[model samples]
Target: MQTPSFYFSRICNALKLAALVCLFLGTSPTWLHAQKSLSNELRAASEQFLATLSSEQKALANLPFDSEWRYDWNYTPRQRKGLPLKQMNEVQRKAAMHLMKAALSNQGVAKAEAIIGLEYVLREVEKRPENDTYRDPENYAFAVFGTPDAQQPWGFSVEGHHLSLHFTVVDNKVEFLPSFFGSNPGIVLPGYVQEGKQVLKEEADIAFRLLGSFDEQQLKKIVLSEKAPNDMLTTNTRKVSLEKREGLSFGEMTSAQQKLFQELLTVYLNKYHVTLKNQELARLRQADMNKIYFAWMGDREPNRGAGRGHYFRVHGPTFLIEYDNTQNGANHVHSVVRDLTNDWGEDLLKAHYEAAHKK
Candidate 1:
């Protein structure tokens, strides 16, 4: 059995050959014609971003696709591998943001920007100094792995405090996985920069609605623990797994309950472009929906204190979604969507490799 990375390398070589063949034949390959329109748009944005960078900045922003750092992703307040937004000039920053926008829906972009803006709210809440290390919205970094070419395998990442978005493209196929979004002061009450603004409001509210619909007997199966965990169980791990599958199965839910659960799932899935989102939805529809589970932990009621400790997770055969508001007195929010077998494009790479090798 060969590793996925090994197949990834072989796929790159095969794609390079395919590119040459297409050029020689004066015709586009089927894969090229079949490429997602969004992938092409994103590649153009990525190239535009690179064009705006100085040599030094470009060096910092680009890295080998196979570098160990490719998997070194996290949603924490710390230094990262790519160029931080603060270091980019206004033009460059705009270019970088364009690349980001290319990968997200309009609503997703709004939510991401709102999450970044919350750093200021956190600074005010903590009363930190001007040079506060953990509260700068511009602290986010952007990095590209491999060259941004439509015919080859490459990827990009935007990561920083409370947000980590990754995209991998190969032969025009895009993989959006290991994506994270978080918020401090999850719900903004009065007196903040944006009063009554909740960055992840839909995520929390829908879960609440779904849980509320559960009867006492159903609740018994869904509430996995008396206490909510302080953070997501799969935080920043290269490989993620849950110790147990304890929750109410999708098969147990009423039709209305199932609809609500799916609506909640759509909130997360909608983070990507429609092309990619549709592809993901198609794969999800093919899965064993009856095997999916929904689990909640911690207090169901609203918290009046400085923070509320609430957590919930939706687990399916191929995907896992985790949302937690147990940190910072429950004022902070962390949520992640992971494709169990496809994070970092493992499945895509594998299939591409096998197909290319077979040919």
Candidate 2:
């Protein structure tokens, strides 16, 4: 009997083949367009997560930040240092923390661990004799918006440098968009940096692993440039543009190669609650998956120091995930998970709230 891993292996190989074929024929992976729909389990898992938020925590989902400002005080950031996860005596904090722990896949856990590593970096940086900077409270704070109770649509932001997760839950359902994760000093300076490693090696390696699978022709479209893009799209914007798909398409790939596309899709969407993940999966299926893109530029490798300039962006229908490691050996890293149609639970929560309004 073939184990699940065996099946996964089969699927993975099939996708690799299909993805390559599309490139050879000048076609993109078309299966990217097909949607088998999210399983009930996925939806249920997401809902279960939402059911856990406390009223206080929901109020802090996300305060509107200025589009022009990158590190505005309005939005939570690691440098500002706001809500301490340890200080939460309220139910909201417990619920949010719980939901986050429960909702994330193994990969998500890995990412979260990477984020925690950053917090430690700041701490270690403060302890250094040469450094004058000390960690501030705002460097790692959580803000609540709306009530956290199931009755009230609410959310919380677990934020720090290059690591912000804005998750909104309404009526026992989940909506996580504009979720972000980042790392600066992907590695510490080669010297005097033993305590703090770049902290973003995993993310870079995993992304490149999938990207490396591509053949020569696929590499051209996927590698937009040697430089990484500025920011992950959809994270800071309302409506986004998909005009970048001119040369990229999945329809050209063989059926098996298309599976690789699916794997890529899985890597990002799986970061949130199952319900929201399902929605994202659905959106990806409906959008021109064949038109999705994987763009790169700048340093193809990572290092201990923040690189001078480097960036990369993956943009496609209902899909936009960007990463920039231009700071240290392309060190400074920024990656965001966005929902083009709805960010901050704008679409679903507002509608759900309106429909249930007593008025």
Candidate 3:
């Protein structure tokens, strides 16, 4: 029997072959329509954003594609390397937002904005000092990797407290992984600016509804433990590794249960542009559903006691989705979607390098 490594090697080889073919094809119509459409749009937006920045701001915003900094991603509150929104003038900030809007779907754009807005909510709730730098919405940083071009490899990242969005475009294919969205006070109460707003409402509610539908045996198979981890197992790690695959398989679930699970998956997958989302959906459909596992930890009830530690994750051959609400008295939330084989466009970059060296 072929080992997992063998299968992974096969996939990589196939991707390399596809990359070579694409390189020689001089831009296929399907590629142009599906991948280049968004790539070109984002490239144009990125150029416009750079155009508005001064030399120093441009220096701060641009980085080499292969820079180690490209892989340095975090959603924690800290000093990061990029042009923060606070430093941008009104025109520059608008251009920066336009670049961001070009990459996300309407729903995704809303969630990102809401996550940034939550900084204000945190300021009021925590009653921090006036000079508290961490709670400012404009603290988010934007950095571009390489020069944006349709035929070459390039990418960008928009990261800040509670959010990290990375995009890589190569030849017309785009890879989005290691994308994160987090919220403190996951569910804003009636008193905040956006009262009763839950940025990740569907992510939480849909999982709970699916868990509620599970029978005793199903729950026994799915619930890995009663205590949740303080944060995701892969928390900001460059390479993700899950210690075990323990959970109820998708094949074991009822048809309705499976449907609900798929819907939950869509909440994360749909955050990308339509073309990328559809491509990922196609890959998911083709994957071995029996290998997909849904595991839950901590209290099953929602909005229960403070810091009760509720967490769950969906793991499969290609993707990992982790949701944790175990910090800040169980009011904080952190969720991430990672492509097992392609985070930071690793696979595509490999293929591009090989194609470039081919005699």
Number of the top-ranking candidate, with lDDT as the measure: 3
Question: What clash count goes with each model?
Answer: 3, 74, 0
Q: lDDT (CA) for every model shown? A: 0.85, 0.54, 0.86
lDDT string for model 3 (74-116, tens) is 9899887789999999999999999888888898999999999
Model 2: per-residue Cα lDDT over 2-104, one tens digit each: 8999999999997886665453322433322211122223233334434544555433333432221213322224343334554455554555455456545
The predicted structure with the larger TM-score, 1 or 2, is 1
Determine the C-alpha RMSD for candidate 3 after optimal superposition of all C-alphas: 6.6
Residue 187, candidate 1: alpha-carbon lDDT? 84
Give the better candidate number (2 or 3) by lDDT.
3
lDDT per residue (tens digit) for residues 1-359 in model 1 = 99999999999997886664553322555434434676788889999999999999999999998888889998888898899999999999999999999889898999999998888888887788767878998899999999998666899999989889999998777888889999877887688777777898888888999999999999999998878999998888998888666799999999999999989988887877766665666566557678889999999975723555889999988889999998878878899999898899987788778888898
All candidates: CA RMSD (Å)? 10.0, 9.7, 6.6
Q: Over the full model, what C-alpha lDDT does candidate 2 score relative to the true structure?
A: 0.54
What's the C-alpha lDDT at position 313 in model 3? 95
Off by over 4 Å in 2: 1-82, 85-96, 122-138, 188-202, 229-243, 254-257, 301-310, 353-359
Clashing pairs in 3: none
> Model 2, 143: alpha-carbon shift in Å?
2.6
lDDT of 3: 0.86
What is the RMSD, in Å, between candidate 1 and the native fold over all Cα? 10.0
After best superposition, candidate 3 residue 327: deviation in angstroms?
0.8
Which candidate's TM-score is highest?
3
